[model samples]
Target chain A: MVSFTAGDAVARRPAKPGRLSRFFFAGNGAGYMFLAPWLIGFLGLTLGPALASLYLSFTDYDLLQSPRFVGMDNYVRMATGDAKFAAAMKVTFIYVILSVPLKLIFALALAMAFNRGIKGLPFYRAVFYLPSLLGGSVAIAVLWRQLFAADGLVNSVLSVFGIDGPSWISNPNYSLYTLVVLSVWQFGSPMIIFLAGLRQIPQDMYEAANMDGASKARQFFRITLPLLTPVIFFNFVIQTIDAFKAFTPSFIISAGTGGPINSTLFYTLYLYQEAFGFFRMGYASALAWVLVLIIAVFTAFSFLTARYWVHYDE
Target chain B: MNDAAHAAPPGDTPERPILHSVLIHSALIGVSFLMLYPLLWMVSGSVRPADDMFGGQTSLIPSQVTLQAYKTGWFGLQVSFGTFFLNSLAISVLATIGNVMAASVTAFAFSRLEFFGKSFWFALMLGTLMLPYHVTLIPQYVLFLKMDWVNTWLPLVVPKYFAVDAFFIFLMVQFFRGLPRELDEAAMMDGCSAWRIYWKIVLPLSLPVLATAAIFSFIWTWEDFFGPLIYLGDIHSYTVQIGLRSLIDSSGTSDWGALFAMSVLSLIPIFLIFLFFQRLLIEGIATTGMKR
Candidate 1:
């Protein structure tokens, strides 16, 4: 089916310029050809859905019939009437507020420890990072459920001290805290980033501080904290977005119910329930836009104030 | 003063401080136990008798060991767990190949070629990395449902061919920028075309990032639960994650040992991949964070 010219290989010699070359390949038409895959995906999957959701937010479709026009009704209902929406938002905020700081603190602490020239850095990094790599998995979520069962490990350990620990995953008062622990436990990702940042700091600065009679605490406050703030801010933004997107763990642990008095009802989980479980696709679309607005505001607020605290030495 | 200066490197802690190592190492080991104990207990729980699993006794090992849980859990409800594993492997491998090829070619264009709206396209690609999936989930699901692709791997695997993962494209773009342009010029001087230079030069030199993209794609696809959960409705077509979740939901605690057994098995492929490619995985993550 295919034919090759005999002199074509010889025509690729280094000594000559062909007349039609520049005219044929003048622009980056081939480049666009290469980029066609992503270009199509952007138009079809991302932009199309984004616009569809915006339009869907204004209607009342439930995947069964045509979406009835109900402009601002969904927003008004969510803002004033939906108790579950309020609860899910509250739980999500609590998760982001508590888990972000705790996870960052642990990450920074471990990164500093690893910077102390400990041998077997790879071993520790591997072990610490394993949880994060596996944290989003169903197996880990199921394990969390089993680990905090009424007669599970935590209660058994508490009983050893003659203390009674409530059923962690089942109790409303304790379930959210258990999820927070799960978030905190996977501190490996931020820890690794912090470690990379720690490695970037000049050692001579600390040595100079040491010679000037600055204590270890002073050196940390003066050198490490100020310099590491950029990485911290970066991690903060990423982890906050991630915490808002938390779903699999709570979904698996709560058996897709978001129950136990709605303690562990995350925003995405609630959005999912609206779209599929209850077939409230239009409501879920509104909820999705609200989530986008929430995330964009947080990200913009961080960027606006970043110059004050997130110092970049260079 | 001279002795102190010459004692050790500046990054090292104070000399003759054995207590420092002791404190740091002990804390790491203790917290490491807290981090790892649940997974270890799951492995142990999968082997013990079903009655012993939920009991008050919390031994790390059982008084007796048995494989009956594995036997029953493998058979599962109707189809076996092996079927799930095979399904995951087939999907992950194909998706990985698709993503790596698409991402690398896209990155090649972004890094090496100049066209209209190039910067805008690059920014848009980076923007997709942060846009939450929920924004796009509904319409994509609707599209797939319309196409009757709901219960198949098409909904899951097809997007990778279209370069749906912006992160990989970003990664490969960074890698491609690091490559020198002299090789391209030399190839052009020898009358080679752009495609020839891409196939012969850039790709050969950028193997590391390509491998990095493939590894991450495979691992993520293998562990992905939400996508498969939303798309696949047939039990016979279940991936391992959906299978595990169904087990938990269906029987509750009627078969704790079997559920634990299946859970432990589900983690094996990721565990092995993580073990062998730890360095590459860490490098990929570290570079993604620090460079940006």
Candidate 2:
């Protein structure tokens, strides 16, 4: 890529870029000038809040009262006593495991179909991606609620074959699955990413496999799967992180409560309830730290395991 | 669009045996139906009378299409939906502009300038991508509350001005890094300052990514519920997302058709944006994912 350099013809500036020169006239000053916004954000909005949240995790600071130091009480409660936290964790892990894999499978399948060289390829891509574009909106979440009601479109569709459908948002067992379906439905981003990955695989590899008398399935496993691993890993890490952060649908569909016996209580929703609803800022900060830890552990695990499976030809 | 992307590779004939072609098309068409069905139902629901919205009626077109829902939902509960739309548009447009501008300058610095601790800063920037927003929510809220910026759009919009959305900045950095180094050198030889090189050379060439940033920031801000939800209290300050939420949560006398109508109306702007910039968004997302 891109790099700016003084041309060789203008070769008089070989002097050292010391403190005074760096501050006054060197590229560093200009560079930092350009980075002012992000720099300020890093120090103030991001780094400050992040560190504060860590400190806040040990205190009982509701908005009304000044934070009183509680010394690991929040952690103790979370680890040892909070049944709701456990339930929320269970619900979220299940949602993430179920949704991420299914969404990726759908994305990969369609991307393969698109790569088969369909006409109006962009149009199809846009149509499929439409859900994802609107996926996080309250309108879509509300629409989801209506679509899965006992009297709603899903049951209506099911009734054609003379079968009944449950009130997906009402039943505790099924409410979480409805959110999972919503997650799966918004597979368009991963689909496009998969398409890009599919494009990067050299056609010659498939041709070479075919020459070796490899069947399509064999070629897929040997050539496609291995080559696609890096992209798969990227999607997995990004989507898993995203799945863990899912809020709008859970909040909107469940009407801001982790209702129907707390089945749809995503971790973020529970965190929200703790912080905003109950104004338990300390407890919520602890929950937030746990989330960061969970994401970091999973990301680290993915990178570790990636060496075994994710092949990068470069 | 890249020519290489569209230009099919040699011997990659898409037209194949009849059975295979039929099967593939059937699968694609079938799945496409699944993909489109929810929106179709939503649109249909929007047009139907309240009584006809649910309960075993799967028809995409009702027997008698009605505008009653539109008429009612447009006014909403007390405040008309138009005010919410304007509020959403104001927030979204301002945020998009801030994001695009902030990301450009920031990306320019990271990509071109030899700065101290650049790698550390870059890593820190990327680290924020996975730092759950919940960590930032309370302190920032507290900070804003102290500033008396709560009950205002500042809490939602101010961070964009600070390049707080690392995703867009990262995306732009990737795009900028992909550009040819020679162009910058040649421009620099003509005595173009780094700012000029950035403003004239880099900015012009980086339209695709900038546009991508604009579109995504717009869509996300428009759809954002949490920030506005947390910061703004009461309906008068509500963005469309919060407005829609209130409409949904309004007690027992819920009007399904009106709700559907309002929902459809809410989706229209995003739909139009997606239709126009569908290619850019797709490519942006792809590049962000695969290139990284």
Candidate 3:
């Protein structure tokens, strides 16, 4: 069947020189006509700006002045001199590490629970997904700030327990964790994805496992976990990338300062501060390149390590 | 298949005991309530009298409901919140239209047409999906600034018209690929132009994907904070997010009622979208494996 289809496709290809030329011309013309907008955007917006930013990273370009080439000074300064850079990196890494795994775990557990033939699955799914839809909005960040305030609902709840709670948003030691909680609160999307992934696993697998006297836990480990690895890997990479780019909650919560001693200064927030707040465009460009590199390395690492864990049916 | 074969036994029958079902329901209910607590608190606080907003009141029910906060929050700032809403609506609508139009055509080209460097361009397009926006942030800002587009919606809306959002294109491409080739082949036999085929045939059949892209684009653009915060300097031009942020800066927790009121108001459009188009939204996410 495959060879037949291959032969059919080859036969359909334009064979005569004149016909082939006409095919090429007409195809290219129509294709380019349809692709004009994307082509323009690709060249003018994406590729052009990317290359310009790369060049800008090595120069001292404030908004007013033309770029003055400064070689690797910005990169060198980031490596050796910038305290806030180091602090931002620490806070962002902590956020990504704490939030992604916790969110995925919560998502997977809830997904498994929902997969157990629960009633009103759609209702529960919608209720769970509400947070993720609204979570990235500025209002949610504002709500988060108030929720963790000293006299806010959290403290009020803690008071009922006869325990005093420090101001989670204001206290430097706890501020980043508040943001982490905020990220984990929006685990709804991943949970939904996991639910979809769960549905794809054949019921026959479980039926077979049950007949073999495999315990529920053993069946999960032996069947579901291995099957769900691809989805897990996908969620891991996407969530990590997203967590690294997290800015709005930290921005609104920190009031654009990333303050209380920069405890919640996300890496993107720091990049924004450098680019817009201080107009240190060159340094900010350098920071942006570093971020791109970091994401690239992480993505490449994920793909490389995926072979060992991410099971696929061939 | 026979009815008996079709009606297979439920897996893990022992686990489906009444008590187990009860436990699962109760656990989900408890977690759901905890998840929604903050939002409920915000809603309750928004209605409570300004004086009653503080002093650690954690109740979901207000002592007395008043429209005072809504009244104050609407006209609170130098420019009323109505203006911000209008601004956000205009931007989101224009951006969504532009994104759907541009992405559809681009996806059609990739899915239905053969051209030189097709695979290479498709690969590049996908590469952009994983490229961090930060890499282009500074240079784009510079380009827009040089064009005297600062404090305007041009920077936000124009690139979308150029199909800068590769995710939408990728989504449409996936959908377009699933469309039967026989339809296009039949159309071509009738002497239909590629444009006509895309416009008259393919697009009508692609309402689901197109609607998915439009809904997501509008919601994401409306929720976007960083773009408006950077580009828009004038309060009159503030998006809903910027206006909400400014309200916080101005109020500084002194007027929690008004802040919460405005916050609630900011979320209403998104809430309405979720309430209405939920099925499409869920199907979109499930098929694409994407989150907005």
The lDDT of each candidate is 0.87, 0.87, 0.92
| DockQ metric for all predictions | 0.52, 0.61, 0.79
lDDT of 1: 0.87
Query: Could you tell me which 10 consecutive residues in candidate 2 chain A have the lowest summed lDDT?
Result: A1-10
Candidate 3 residue lDDT tens string, B102-150: 9999999999999999999999999999888999999999999989999
Q: lDDT of candidate 2 vs native?
A: 0.87
Winning candidate number (TM-score):
3
Interface RMSD of each: 2.4, 2.3, 0.8
Q: How many clashes would you count in candidate 1?
A: 0
Tens-digit per-residue lDDT, A1-314, candidate 1? 12345366455642354544543454357778889999999899999999999999999988779889899999999999999999999999999999999999998898889996786788888889989988988998988887787877889878888888888888999999989999999999899999998988999999888878798899999999999999999999999999999999989989998878999999999998999899888999999999999999999999999999999776
Tens digit per residue, CA lDDT, model 1, B83-178: 898999999998999999899889988998777778999999989988998999988988999999999999889999989989999999999999
**Model 1 residue A275 CA deviation in Å:** 0.5
In candidate 3, which residue ranges exceed 4 Å CA deviation?
A1-15, B1-16
- Which candidate model has the greater TM-score, 1 or 3? 3
Task: Tell me each candidate's TM-score.
Answer: 0.93, 0.93, 0.95
lDDT of 2 by residue, B129-175 (tens): 77878888899989999999999999899999999989998999999
